[model samples]
Structure formats: C-alpha cells, structure tokens
Target: MLEIRNLDYRVEARPLFEGASARVSAGWKVGLIGRNGTGKSTLLRLIREEIAAPGKDSPIRLQNGARLGWVAQEVAPTDQTILDVVLEADAERHALMQEAETATDPDRIGDIHARLLDIDAWTAEARASEILMGLGFTTADLSRATREFSGGWRMRAAIAGALFAQPDLLLLDEPTNYLDLEGAAWLEGYLRRYPNTVLIVSHDREMLNRSVTHTMALEHRKLTITPGGYDDWLKLRAAKLAQLESQKSKQDKDRAHLQAFVDRFRAKASKARQAQSRIKMLEKMQEITVPIAERTLPFSFPEPETKLSPPLLEIEDAHLGYGPQAVILKNVRLRLDPDDRIAIIGTNGQGKTTLVKSIAERLPLLAGNRKVPKKVEIGYFSQDQLDELTEGDTVLEHVMRALPKDTPVAKQRAVAAQIGFSHEKVETKVEKLSGGEKVRLILGLIALAKPHILILDEPTSHLDIDSREALIYALNDFPGAVLLITHDVYLAEATADQLWLVKDGKVAPYAGDLADYRALVMSSDREKAGATKASADPAEDRRRNAQARDTAAPLKKKADAAEKSFEKANARIRTIDTELARSGLSPQKMTELSIERGKLEAEAAKAEEAWLMALEEYEAALKESAAS
Candidate 1:
C-alpha cells in the first residue's frame, strides 16, 4: 500500500507535480500512465524515496516493512553471468551462503546452514532459472556473460533479478519493451497470481488490460487514481470527458451570451439593469474545464501511387536467418496483397524480426525464392532506423531532407506539426529527443516517402498511449499493405486485418485473435504447473486443491477448441485439393488454386500442432485433478 498527500515536485524551477495526492491499497496492481515527459518516471522515483518532496510536510508513505523491487533500466556492462546476477537478488541468502562457506567453527557453520535452510537457499539457483526462462532466457543463456548481451536484453536480466527477489512491492517501468509476445504473456499470467502490490508503468495496452487491477494517471500536474483495468479506464474516461465537454460547451455559450448583452447595453440606462443582472449571473457561475486535451494531430500516410496489386510479395518455401549457416525460420510460404494488414506475433528470439527483414528484402532469404514486384516500394520503420537520423540533425531538418529540395519551408513546418513535433521541439537535435519523439520523426519521414507498403517492427514499443492512439489512427487510414512485427497487441488489433503467427520455426495464419492467444498461453502454463504438482499428498487441504483445479479447468476447453480447429482446417484442405483436381480448369486458375491449397495445408499443419499441444495440456490437467 502507498499514499501521497499534498505532493509537490519540480525540475529546475518547473513544476511537474503540484498539490497532487494518490492512494494505492495493499495488494493492488496499479498501472501508472501518462504521456511522455509528464513525470511518470519521476513520480516513481519520488515514491521510491530517491527524491524528496518540495517541503517536509508533503507526505509519501508505504506500508512499513514493504520491500520494494525495481530493476535498473540501465545496467552497466558487467562480466557476471546472467544466472549469477539473478541469484544474487536475495541479499540475505547470498550472505548466508558466504558465511557458511568461510566459517571454520562448528557452531558458527551450523548456525549459518540453519539460516540458509530457513530461507530455502538451496533452491535459489532453480528459482532464478525459472524467472529467467519465463523472461525468454534459454538454458544456454543462463551462463552467458551479461556484458555479451545488448542493452535491451541486459535489461531483461535486470527484470529477472527483480522477480527473483520476490519483494512485497514490484515496480516495473515499460518492462514489456524487451519482451516478445510470449514473454509478455508469461508476465501477464505471473501478475495474475502475484501475492503483492505491483505498480508497472507500461504502454502495452494488452498487458495493462490483463495484469493491472487499477490505473493511476499523472495528468494536469496531478496524480489521479482510477479503480479499473485499461478497458475500464477507457470507459470511465470517455464518460467523464463527455460530461465535462458538454458542461464546458454550455457554460461557454452562456458566458458568451452574457458578455454579448453586457457589451451591447452596458451604458444605456434602459437596458442597464438587465445587462448588469446577466453579468452577475455569469460571474457567479463556475468555470468548466474539459478533462482531456481538445487538440490531437491526425496523421496519415501519403497515398500510394500504385493500386490493386495482389501478391505484392511472395516467398516460396523460404528459409530465413542471418549469414549462411543458421536458419531461424524455415519453410516459409507467404503472399502479400495490396491491402493486407498482416501482424506478425511471437516470443522474443523467435525470428519475427528476421522474417520481417526477409520480406522487406533487407536481408537475403538463406534458401528458396522470393518474388517482389519491381514497381512496389516499401517504407520500413524499425528501431535501427533511428540511427539514420544523425545526432546533429533537428526534427525539422530530417523531415525536410526526406522531401524534395524545392519543398517550401512552410510545408516542412507543417509536416513537423503533423507528426506531433511542436515549434520548440522542431529545433531540438534528434539525439536529444525521447524514444517516442524519435519514432515520430522516423514515421514522419516514412510518411513523406509515399511508399506502397509499410513494414513496422514494434512501432509502438516506445510510444505513450496518446502517441499509440495517433499511430493507430494513421495506420487505419493508410491505403497500403502493412507488415507489422509488434508485441503491442492493442495497436496490432486496431491496425491489422490479419494475424501471422511466427512460432516454432514456422509462419502461419493463426486461427484466432489476440484474446484467444492469451487464453491459450495461460492454459498451457497452468497445465505445465499442474503436471509438476500432480503427485498430491493425501493430507493436502481441499481448498488449495480446489483453487488449482479451478485454474486448470480452462485447459480442457482450450483442447476442445483446438480439436475443432484441426477438424475444420483438415476439411478446408480436402476441399482445396478437390478444387485443384477439377478437370478443364484454366492454367492460371489451376495455378491460383494450387497456391490456395498450399495455404490451407499450412493452416492445417498449424492446427494439428495446436491440437497436440492442447491435448498434452488437457491430459496433464486431468492427471493433476485425479491425483488431487
């Protein structure tokens, strides 16, 4: 539990929070959200006691003895192995182990051993391994040097270390940026059963929707608490905004009328009383302030020159990976239509980005042939593209450079504004901008090019909710094909018309949407846990077993759904084969039909895989239930 009263904070004489207050009950999972530069991170620091209130009277308190767990966003390069870093999270246990190792006296060694046993220090390594695996660490990666990893991946290890500590309060700031879809799913399930307070600051809507029980927003220089998940927050905010806007509109109109009357008849003796009465009425009325911003930049991609081209890019039995010896994704058969909005989803290191690169022709498809239309142009946006905006260049300079040399300065300024860069921000160097600002610049450049297709990899990873909403609006109106690889399920759902599941070295159309995928991941994790606890002791309490059983019930339903999907896919495959077998079909028609059959076969294979996985989980659940 946490509380703040009369809180005030500032940076260099600028007030970030003024007379703000907030409350978080014990056991609540609250999401802290606000636009970038609104002091979301700064507020977390204040709560963590890294910063002081402007006055001693201002209060920021947490429950006594509440342990705080926050991973450093920036971990300096170190020679420590990943597992070693996680295992060291438990300070007491680590100290006990050191004491036990060095103590020569029998009694001292015995005491150290007893203390270690009390803390279950023997399983510390295994527990660390579990957290690491949940965060997408492979067995081989456990012993790898932390310095060997990229900054994003090192942060994953840092996050794992926090989870390893098992503190009473876990504070995460944009923890999902480094996670793929699978790791994000694992985290959502982990948070569901978390027996502590959690305050995570994230822009991933799906994560907030699933993991948080409450929402805390820093807006208008005040910290406000709302009791609900992300979806509920949206509903509550929409209603509040509507009411506030309505009141503001009516009040403004009435004030205008009163002012108009006063202006017209203030000095005239005959109408003076009436005008004075109206003035008094207007003065006594309270002012209405709208809850949300009235201004939003509506950004859209430039119209593509070409239109209505089916099969814009196709890959035939391709294998994709870096260099020549490794193939991370194999046997890929895909086609891109003129208006296809395909979203690629999977866990980290599952080749989602690699597949995107192959399709974008940024990398060679190690094996098989790729056919891309000669006339097609692709606008690619990725984190690496940030490097292209050199340090000395300003946002306005980048936008104008992407345009024709003869482009007017006014037009350049308009583009900057269109992309959410303000007059002051336009002059800021690219290196000094926030991550979201850099992405906006890249998207602004992409928009200027008017490409026929857009390939975005985790485009919304660094953006706030407002910027994410803006990007969704843009993509919704974009009249071009989209190939998106993102863990931001919210943006994917809004922008994508089709989902491409990249997993287990295969890319295929998923049979369901984001919701179903989440459920599947949850059920699978539960079943795996159930199997390990299947050998229940006869004396185990009924309530604990019942709780476990309740969680496991969803596994059976998922299995049933998978079975139905498999049957449907098989039937579709047979029908496609029948169509291919038909006599007197035109050569071109047969060729098209063959392609359709291949797709159905792939879908059926995916369905078959899902059926096997579901069956495995259902059987494990049944065994655990029987044992209980």
Candidate 2:
C-alpha cells in the first residue's frame, strides 16, 4: 500500500536517513523499531506524507485510492463528545442511513438505494461499534464529552476514531501507551484480524511480537526491512553483532603478528628485506575500522543512609479526588516497608494519579491522614519535571541550583558528567534542551538529592530503551524504598518487589511475582470482559426486559387457563380409555398424541426455569448496582 524509494531525510545538514527504501505490502503488519532519536516517528510521518523529503522523488508514494489513518503519539481532545468524533469517521455511511430513514416516497427510494450502495450503510454502524468496543469504549462511554476526560482517555478515544475509519492503511505510534493490559490485548486481536496494512511504532515487546508480522529496523543511517517479528529481528541482530566481534578479533590478531614480524627484523642487516616487506605489507593492508560501541550514561544512585520502619508511608481512610465531586477511595489502608518497591497499577482515570498525587503531597486528602516517618526524605519525579526547570537557566545551572550549599563545585560537575551531560552540554540553555536531555537533567538532580524514598510517575516516558535500562539498574541498586506509577509492565516486572492493584474504586495488595501479577490482571480483565458482553447495551437490555415481563405476564395467565383445560382433557381421556378398554377399541393413536402433549408440557416447564433464571439475574444485577 505504501512505498519509499531512495529516500534521504536530513535536518540542518545532518542526515537522519540516507538511501533508505522500504515497501509495505497489502495486509502487512510492520513494527517500526529503532533507538531513540533515530527517526522512528520521522519515518512514520514520511510514510504518512505529513512531512516532505528534500529530493526529486518524494519520500513516500501511496497506491491509488488507498485511504490512510494515523494514531498520533500525542493526542489532544477536541470539544466534541466521544461518540460524535468516532461517528465522524463514517459520515458518508451515516448520511446514507439518514437518507434511507427519511425515504418514505417511491421517488426518493431510488436515490436512497444509490446512496446505500455508495456508502455501504447497512453494515457500517455495526463495524464501527465493533471496533470501538474492541478498543475498550462502550456505548455509554461514547456519549461522554471529551473535554471531561483525562489526556489518557482522550487518546484512547482518538485511537478509537482512527480504527473506526477502517482505512486501507493504519499507522499507530505507541498505541499501547495509555492502554491497560485488556486494551492492549484487544488491539492485538484486532490487528491480527485486520485486512489492511499496518505500521506501528512501540516500545512494547509483547505488542510488537503479537501484532507485527514484519520488523523494520532503522540503524546506521539505513532501513532494514525484515520479514519476521521482534524475536526474529533480535536473533538477526545478535548474529550481526557476533560477526562484527569476530572480525574485530581477527584484525587485532593479524595486526599483532605483523608487528611482531617487523620488530624481529627492524635492526638486522641480514633480514632487512623481510622487515621492509612486512612494513610495506602493513602499510598497504586495508584498515579494518571497527564500529564504535554505543555510549551509555553511567550514573549510579547512592545508597540510602537508613532504612525506614514498617509503614514507610501510610494513608488511613483516605478520600482523594478533586473538589466536592471527589471520587472517594474510602477506608483505604496501605503499608510500605523499607524493601518494598511497589508498582501502582490501574486503568486510566481510575484514581491512580490522584493516589500518587496525594502521596507526593501535590494534593491534600480530604478525610484521612497520611503519615511519613521523620527520618525519611522523599524524592519525587513527576511528568511535570520539564516545567520545574527554569526557562532561562542552563542545564548546569539547573543542577547547581539543586546542589547543597556546602557541596564542592567539582563534585557537582562530576554528578552532571555521570548523567551524560558534559561540561559543554551543561552550559547549553535548558530552553534548548530536548526531551531526553531534560529527563537526564532531572534524574541528575534526583540522584544528588539522594533521598530515602523515591516516588516516580511515568518516569520512563520519553526515555529511550537504553535510558530505561539504566534507570532500572540504578533503582534496583538503590537502597531506598521506591514507589512507581507507570504503564510499562516490563519495567515494573524488572524493578518492583511488590504490587498494588487499583480497580473499581478500591485498592488491593497483591502478593505475587511479576508473572502472577500479569495473570491476575488478565483474569480481572476477563471478568470485566464477561460483564461488558452481558451489558453491551444498557438501553437495549432495559427494553428487552420490560417487553419480556409484559409478554410473560399474559403468557402466565394463558398458561394457567391451558393447564385447567388440559386437566379437563386428561379426565375425559381417562374416561374414554376406560370405555374403549371395555368396548375392545385399541385407543393406541389417542394414547400417542396424549404422550406427545405430555412431552410438550415438560418443555414448558424447562422454559419456565429459563425465564425465572433470567429474571433472577436481572434482580441480582440491580442489587449489585451500588457496587459498580
């Protein structure tokens, strides 16, 4: 559906990609993978035709009449209801349906028929609703205004909109960023069954493995399109790295042997020819340039001075939310010990952020008290770290401002260097810093603070894979108690020692390993999935139940009357059978029909059981309504 030929993209004379070519076939699911700043998003934009390349041939060329839909990495909500925005994806179908609805006259019927043929109106709404539900949006959620939702939920709605379009080609950038495990699984299932082409950029290994049939890697100013998943790509990468290492070793050995031969005969007149020959051979040899190893930041967090007692931080019956319309978490209790590295898990907009904010002292709890030990010093890292930095200050100035008054200048410089900021980079203004640089600066300050407790909210956001690994390593080694709020399950599994699961306005302490935690989350999602299926349409359920009750009431009356009539018929049949026995009539045919009627009566009993079960379920649902 899309093709790139001899594409070269550059910014300010620096080449992002050179001579890069890739072809995406119909129904292909491609995972666009690369290190940060290697232009994964840029390549996507190029394929999307949102950005133009500087060459005779355009960066991207699409097949004729191929439609494209994109889910951006960052989404902003418009002032529209979630339903209207998703419905807009199929406006033509909607219009056709409207026309068909109003087509009462025979003259207008022909026009409606043509419109239906053009729009495929009959099946469009079903398809749209299916896509939306698969992405974790319900019919009820559809009507909610977008402005009232958080950024994460708004992104989900945007994703729903993109999928509802059912384009010929779909481009998703980090689609799983704001999704829970259930949402991610649903997307995987949808993409697996998708008939169109797909290209996605994601850091999630499971997502890439499950959703992508091919892997497109960008490295060394080139694009390598391979036909396999992430594991296959990783194996290929390992083989390439091994080959490079072997070649480097052979070159080193050959150089050492040549040097030894030259040294043995350099000063001997008798063997001067051999020496000259070896020297000339060395000079003429093609130099093997070993690839430069990637650089990594080397900051290790300092150990905590002392461990806190049990209940590191506690909330007693906390009620946290905004204003009088607070979404209360009542009678909440949690205890964190010194060794606990807890992961806060929940769906988006389900008080995960509110709970974290209260713990971080960014918000005050309305009802309950939160306690922190006197000896514990807290280090908090939030999504707003970038905003915390002074606009006009340089990177070094920012770090220096966080340093203690008695701290030496040399020590401060060393700290900055450890976080990959050099003397020159440190002098660069904070306003000019990129996202990664800003994160590094904030981490540097946090490390300097060396608090006993660290609370980080989505700390891995905007960080490259290498940076994430480095942070994980540092946190693992740190002696402090860590409280993390993140969507990166892999990171949580690697670093957390405890898990706290929040759902349905309550929090539960989970005592399990990472695998178990995943299973629990999946199980909870399955239960919710069943509930979603049962209550797919609240309005429809109510209507059907009301109609069923109405029909059932009249049927019960008729059934009673039929039972009375059947009792009379049974008495008459018995009398006739007795008379027939005396009259020597066989009466076998009447007996057979009587037996058939009895079987029908048994079937009626079963139907009554089924009806009662349905009614009981309806009643139980009402009883549990308060909990939901």
Candidate 3:
C-alpha cells in the first residue's frame, strides 16, 4: 500500500504533475495509464523512494512494510547462473541456509535444525521450481550462465527473480515487452493469481483488462483513479468529452448573444452600460483550451509499378541463429507470397527475430538457399532503431541520407514535414530526439527507401498508444508484402493476415486470428490445470472405493497398485497447491488463481457428472447385450 499526497514532479522545468494525489491501497491491482513521457516510470520510482520530490517538504509518503518489486523496461544480466539469480530473491532464506551450514557445535546444530524445519526448506524449493517452469525455464536452463542468454531471456530471469521475492507491492513496467505469446500468457495468469497490491505500466490492453481491477489515468498534470479496466475508463472519458463539448457550445451561444447586444445598442446610453457590463464579463470568462494534438505518423506506401507473382521471398532448409554454436532454427523452409502479411511469434530466444533477420539479409545464412525476386527491394526496421541512428546527424540529414541523390533538398524537407518533423525539429540533432521522435524519423527514412518488401521488428516498441494505432493503420493500408515480428498481440491481430508460430526450433503456419493462435499456445497449460483439479477431486472417493474392493478380492495386489497411483497423484496436487499457497494470497494473485481454479474445478465436476451418466449408459448397454 502506498499514498502520494499533493505530489509535484517536474523535468527540465516542465511540470509533469502538480498537486496530484492518489492512493494505492493494499491488495489493489491498478493499471497506470497515460501517454508516453507522462512520468509513469517517475511515479513508480517515487513510490519506491528511489527519487526525491522536487520540494524538500513535499507530502509524498509510502505506507510502512510495503515491499515494492519493480521489473525495469531494460534488463542487464550479470555473470551468474540463472538459478543463482532466482535464489537471490529470498535473501533472508539464503542467509539462513548459509548460517545453518556453518553451524558445527551440537547446540548450534539443534538450533539450525529447528530453523530449517520452521522455514520449510523442501516446500520453498518446490515452489521455486514450479515458478521457474511456468516462466518457460527448463531444469537444464537453470544451470546456464545468464551472460549467454539473449535480452529476452534475461528479462524473464529478472521477472522470475522479482516474482519469487513475493513483495507486498509489485510495480511492473512493461512486463510484456520482450515476452512471446506463450510467456505473456503465463505472466498474465500468474498476475491474476497474485494476492498483493500491483501497479502496472503496460500497453497490452488484454493483459490490463484481465489482470487489473482498477484503472489509474494520468493526464493533464493530474491523476484520477477510477474503478474497472481500460474499456470502462474509455467510456467514462468519452462521456466527459461530450460534456465538455456541450459546455463549449453553451459558452459560444452566450458570447454570440453578448456581441449582438453590443452591436445593436452601442448608440443608446442606457443600453450601452449593459453592453459594457456584458463585454467585461466576457473578458473575465475563461477561454477554452484544446488538448494537445496526439502524435501520429501518417504515410502510405507509393503504389508499386508492377506486382510480382510467386516467390516474393523463399528460404529453403535454412539454419538461422547468432553463430554456428548457437543456432535456433534448423532446416526451416519458408515461403512468402506477394501479399502475405505474416506475423512471426514465439518466446524470446526461440528464433522469431533471427528468422526475420535472415529474411532481411541482416545476417548471413549458415546453410541454406534464400531466393528473392531479382528486383525486390527490402526495407528493414531493426528492433534497436534508436541505436542504429547516427549520433551527431540532424533529423533532416538522416532522412536526406536515405533519399536518392537526384532528389532536391526542398523535396527532402517536405518529406520530413509529412512525417511530423517541422523546420526547427528537422535541424535538431538525432541524438537529442526522444524515442517516439526517433521512431518517426526512422519511418521517414524508410518511406524514402520505397522497398517492395517491408520487415519491421517491434516497430511499436517506443510508440505511444495513438502513434502505435497510427502505424498499424499505415501498415494495414500498405500495398506491399510485410513480415512483422512483434509482441503486441493487439497490433498483430489488427494488421497481420497470417501467423507463423515458432516453437521448439520449428515454424508452424496458422491460418486464423491471433486469438486462435494464443489459444493454441495456452492450451497445454489450460489442460494441465484442468486435469490436476479434476484428478484431485475424486481422489479420496477412489481411495475409499479401492479400500472396500481390495478387501474382497486380490487384497494385496489391488491395494498396493491403487495406493501407488493415489499417492502419485496426491503428491502432484500437494506440490501444486504448495506453490499456489506460497504465492501469498495477494488480490491480483487471488483473482488470477481463482479464475484458473474455477475453470479447472468446473471441468473436473463436469467430468465426474459425465462419468456417472456414462456408468448408467454402460449398465443399460450391458443389460441389452445380455438380452441379445
């Protein structure tokens, strides 16, 4: 639980929030929503007391005993094993374990034994293992050095470390950033079951809707906390916008009436006084201020002079990866048609990015034949666009560099303006631009290239919601082939026509909606959850029935076999339950696990009922068969 009272935040003399107050109550799951650069991350730092208030005497206070765990947007892995990092989450436990090992005296040995039992060491390990597995970490991966993994895998380890800590308040900044559909779904489910307070800054709407119970909107230098998710907030905002429009109309009518009176009665002494009073009142009335214009990138591809048939791009028996030692894709055969809007999806390090790079020719293939149309031009927007920009070059200079030599300077400036860069902004050094501005500049440069096939890798990474929507709109209307590798499921759903799901070093094509693809990836976890609950429910009943039947026939043989099966299943259920319990009944976790448990319990109950019905049917069948 945390409380921010009369908070003021500023950056470079610009006020971000003034007199903004909000409370994050215990056990509340809140979605922190705002435009980019609105101080969402700043607010999180304030809550964690990592940064000081602008004023020395500001009244921003955090509740006592509120442990905050934050997952940063960028993750840097140190040289350590994955398991070591995860175990570090329980710092106190690690200390206790170390102390226990060093104790040698008889009296100290007894004390250590008591402490170990009290801490439930076996249960903790089981819980840790379960959490690691859910995040897509195999037992083998746990021993690998973190330095060897990719950025996405490092992010997963960081997230696993935070969740393992089980803090009282979790602040997740774009937790879905580097995750694939499978990893994202797992995290969503895990957050649903979290019991502590949560304040999340994310752009994924579905994740927000499913995980959060409240929405916090930060706009116009103020914070408003409202009940329900983003959709509810949007509805409320629309109503407010309508009300403001109505108010503006009324003010316009009053101004018109006053003007008319002033014009009609200017010569009359008695009426002149009233007109003067109305004019003064109009002067005193507050002027309506329009909201800031939303940033957008609006440009469509130039119509292709000729459309090429068959074999837009083809990869035959290709192996894609970083190097010979770390290949992710082995013998992958892929074909792109003239109009294929394919979306590549998989967990980080699973080769979605490598596959895209291979197609873009950013990396050379180790072993395979890749054929592209003779005249096909490719425009590639790598994931780290900001890093790729020249440091000292101006925005206009960068755009001009991408243009053909025959193009005039005036035409280059005109193209830059169309992408939202103005005269002064065009002259600003590329190093000084914000993330969104960099993305816009890149788009402008890409537009000049006019490639037949466009490949975008996480193009929406730095874009705000409005800009992301605008880019999606442009991509949808483009008249060229596209291969997009992004984690934004909403964007993928809106723009892509086909999905290439990468799993276990193989790509499988799915000819359906993004939702269907998500369902396919999550089906395994859903089935496991269902089976566990179903198998656990009738466990005692079966045990009792087995006990009665064993007494009558093959007493030792049947009893031993039945007991073995019962123990095996019961052990698994107990293990899962222990992990769930250790997650600590936070509001978010409760909502999530309750949802999961409800589904599983429902399925289990249904199966039991169906089994009873089937028993009745089978008895009738036996009677009919006997008669025959």
TM-score each candidate.
0.77, 0.74, 0.75
Name the runs in model 1 displaced over 4 angstroms: 74-76, 104-111, 242-288, 292-294, 525-628
Please, what are the lDDT tens digits per residue for candidate 2 over residues 88-148? 6665666666777777898788877877776666555556555555566654454445653
Candidates' C-alpha lDDT: 0.78, 0.71, 0.72
Specify the highest-lDDT model's number: 1
Better by lDDT, candidate 2 or 1 = 1
Question: Worst ten-residue run, lDDT, model 2?
Answer: 618-627
Per-residue lDDT tens digits of candidate 3, residues 1-628? 7777888889888998899988878888999988888898888888777888877775576577666787654335566777677777776667777887787898987887777687665466555655665676654455445754556667888888788777888888877766666677777878888988888998777777777889998888889998888878889888877787888888889988988988899779989889898889889988765456455557556645567877788899988764453456788898887677988877544667768878888667888999988878777886565666755579888878777878899998988898789978899998899877888888767766677788988887677667777888888887788899877777888888888877677887867777776776568753343233222344553444334333323322433354455455445544545656784567877677556654554444444333332332232222222222
| Candidate 3 lDDT score relative to the true structure | 0.72
Error in Å for residue 492 of model 2: 1.3
Q: Candidate 2 overall Cα lDDT vs. reference? A: 0.71
**Lowest summed lDDT window (length 10), candidate 3:** 619-628
